[model samples]
Target: MTETADAVTTGTERPDFPLDRRRCPLAVPQEYERMREENPLAPVTNRMTGKPVWALTRYRDVRQVLGDPSMSSNARNPSYPAQFHVPEEMLPYIAFPFPAMDPPEHTVRRRMVIPEFTAARINKLRPRMQQIVDTQIDQMLAKGGPLDLMAELALPVPALLFCEMLGVDPVHIGYFRRYAETTTGRDSTQEAVAGAIAEMDEFLDELITEKTKNPGDDLLSRIAARLPDEPTLEHEDLVAIARVLVIAGSDTTANVVSLGTVVLLEHPEQLAELKADPSLWPGAVEELLRFLSILDSATVRVATHDVEVSGGTIRQGEGVLALNGAANWDPERFPEPDRFDIHRNAEGHLAFSYGNHMCPGANLARMQLETVFRTLFERIPELRLAADVDKLSYMFDAHAYGLHELPVTW
Candidate 1:
């Protein structure tokens, strides 16, 4: 492997976590490739905390760290590697509830809403999801092209679908989308982040209260109904759950849709193969998810006990970042990892992570992606970028990596 300047290590100095990839937004940081080859469990300084932590780069080591019970996901822990450095007072409002909880609490909280995202449950919503996607595209077509796809379709389709799932009023979708962008955007001020969190909590609190009095056929309503039977689940807990769902279910999927479209458009030969053979859609979506590991850096934890991984031991009280992007790009697991072949068996990629803390909304996200890609290109076969690829702005400063805008034409 050709060693890039990013991989060069000297003395005992550690590189900052989340190596810069602005040079190639669509690709994993080349530093990860070197770390995987030389130091599978390389030490790095947390950019947020300014503390040293272990960064797991290989697929096996990342899976191992994620599945191990000794690794703690509690954000309250001083050692947990937080993506953003929020004030301690604001942690409760900002930190994701279930994802940052350690089981049996995490298990209990996750199980409360697990049925809502099952393949069976999400499949039942497929019709409505398709309708939502179609409506967004119809609106887009009416407006004509030479417009930002991110604003027209990529952002709204998933936001509308998530609102439908959570029984959130469609009118409030715009606010929710803004809240997600601000809270997750790296450049957002602390006051802005806190305000967004407060606004979300207030909205969810009201929604949950309404659900209790007039329950609906939605996830939040169902959770509200359980409050009478389950004393452990509080009203705030319901709000927190819904808040996380809104952020995860919408923003992440929206990113995948926009970024994935760029990938398909950039690879016309593979795009033609997909358009010609509908059977490849599912595999194409998986490949896209694998290729663009947007949420990889979010999988972080603090070792509660000494844990042995591929490279070395992670002693208790030390933070560890299991970079899913790096693992997906690890050539040890995937040959020619940089290549984006739709037919590659990209199963077991850590895009949604693995084990207990695996993203519960993964199935729903996949279905939405498949629907968007299948319907999009079929409806607009001539869809192509309106501007040069280099001119496109990317969300390198956001918690998730994606295109800031995708100007397209047909």
Candidate 2:
């Protein structure tokens, strides 16, 4: 691996933890590389607040910090590293999802929905998922000519799947999509986000009420069934879980699909190779996830106890963020990390994160990505970008980095 010649080896602290969108669409922030080498536990100021927090960069250091129980995932803790500043008025909507809860709370909450995303459950959904992919492709093909794949395919597939998973009516997808987009949008105001949250909670509350009376086999129904027995899993808990699952299930997967398409198109040689070998699609999906590392701020924690990392101590009550993108791109972890190799064994990359709080729907995401890429290539062998790469718009401020629209034609 070639050395990062300009890596900072002294004067560790940087002002902002995560540098804004890189000039090059596919490149990682330069600050990450410098910090990984010089200051694995770099102290940086959170952009949302002027408060200081530790940003862990190196692969080993990041992995250690995430798995360490001393690093609390409880967002209720005031020291928790929030992605954006939450206005005092919006505090009621700050309910902790399973991912943000600590210990027994997280474990109990996680188990409630674990059955829905099990390997068997995902396997059962595969046939329907394929049909979803085919139907979307059919619509795109019928429309013909220059099309935005982001609108026509990537966004719809996951959104519709999420609707199906939650037993939400297809007609209400527009409402759901709006709230999902705004919640993760960097440009949205706290008031706008709070409004979205309130609207979504109101919707979920109604859904839960309906499910309680007339239950189905869908995820919401299952949660409803558990409500009577699981006292901790109350009405509000169910609503919060549903909201988080829908937003996460739709947003992250959609971004991956859009960004993955961009990566494959940019590297035609690799794209062609995958097209020739259908079996390679699964590995290709894993590689793309590892290579992309779209959700840069997925894992943030506050220290519950003084934890020593790379010779420094993260004192109790201090906030920390594990830079998953840096870990995925670390040369020590992924050799020649910058090279986008479809066949690379990227099994352990931190794309879905690691340890207890690893993304619950990781398997579901993998299946969707594999099916979408394979089906797309098989259907449109000549597909290429309709717009110039440099001119394309990207959602730089989004929690997930992805193309705003990928204009493509066959």
Candidate 3:
């Protein structure tokens, strides 16, 4: 059954929720716009679930659902929204530490790693981030034009930074990066995902043991420090935490850097404005975050109790997908939502989401982006796409929405 603005439909007539990546830069799906204006909380079929779930499109409704305590993020819940079907053998392995937990447990697990992501900690890394950005740019310049930007700069910047942060031995980065790619890429096969997980589990188990014996200032050592009293996080928990951190921190920033660069290049006027004034970099980052919301469904909440939203009622046990892309485009919240104006204040945008589950790595991602964007155009003023924008291949099936490879010339 599908719920529409004025009536309900059965079987063959369900309103389909299209979740494909955008073909045009900075464009929200047309279906999202239609639902927001017409059926703000329409019941549409999740292609993966084959069940009618609430697709909350309006900004207010999406934010409310994100912040609502009654809504559960735990995938273990009977009615929890699992975007893809998990194999029976893998059910127990999918309970990710914090992002997939709720309440006190979520709060506790997050607290363990909070110190690593604090503003001061992130601020301390700016110099190193700048160095990484510089080295990548220097190599690109030496190689001269016609480089795949994704490989030359975008992918390496964050991958190297994450390795430094995690204190993984430089020798292991090759395999680690391969495992991460397989695990996070949506198009990766089940066998590949399982192999990646097993490889990571073995590596992290040894790393955590080593860190326990000789603790360092890195995050793994910090987790080792908590092992004694935090019985909730056993050996398996430590591996889970490390795996999640690695998967979460790497590609997301890389994609943002690539996609954000494309967006800026598309609007030479905005690019020139930013290049002329470095002071605008911070605000420009925020606008880019808002304008290029990579995830179609950033926050998926399962209602534990009946809740009345602005448009309609979300029944208990029903899954609700809050589309950040749609909410970012809501006209009520952002004035002239479609326009990409770096001068506009896009501060309150839901790019990193809101409330308790907001991405902890947001500050780190911002600093990297600010540094990279500031330095790239400043160094190579003639930078432009090597091929027509339409000719570039995009990662529609990746965990993060980005170009498969951004070819560029300077």
Clashes of 2: 0
Q: Tell me the tens digit of each residue's lDDT in model 1 across 1-410.
A: 23221243566658887775677877888888788888887778777766678889998999899899899999888668888757766555454678989988788789888888899998998999899889988988999989999999898888888888888888987788788889887778778877888888998899899999999998888878776665677888888888888888668998999889988998999999999998899999999999999987999989888788873678878889999999998887888989999999999999999999999988998899999999999999999999887678888788888888899999
Candidate 2 versus truth, CA RMSD in Å, comes to 4.0
Clashes in model 3: which pairs?
none
Task: Return the top candidate by lDDT.
Answer: 1
By lDDT, is 1 or 3 better? 1
**What residue pairs clash in candidate 1, if any at all?**
none
lDDT, model 1: 0.85
Question: RMSD (Cα, Å) of candidate 3?
Answer: 2.5
> Candidate 3 residues 1-410, lDDT tens each?
23332234454355655477455645777777888887788777765545667888899998999999998898777566555444546766564657878978888777777788889999999999999999999999999989999988888888888888888866665676677668656557677777778778888888888888999988789777987877766777777788878876667888888888888999999999899999999999998888888766757888888888864688778888888889998999998888989998998888888889998888888898999999999999999999988777787766567887999997
Worst 10 residues of 1 by lDDT: 1-10
Quote the positional error of residue 235 for candidate 3 in Å.
2.6
| Candidate 3, superposed: residue stretches over 4 Å from native | 1-18, 22-25, 229-231
lDDT of each: 0.85, 0.83, 0.80
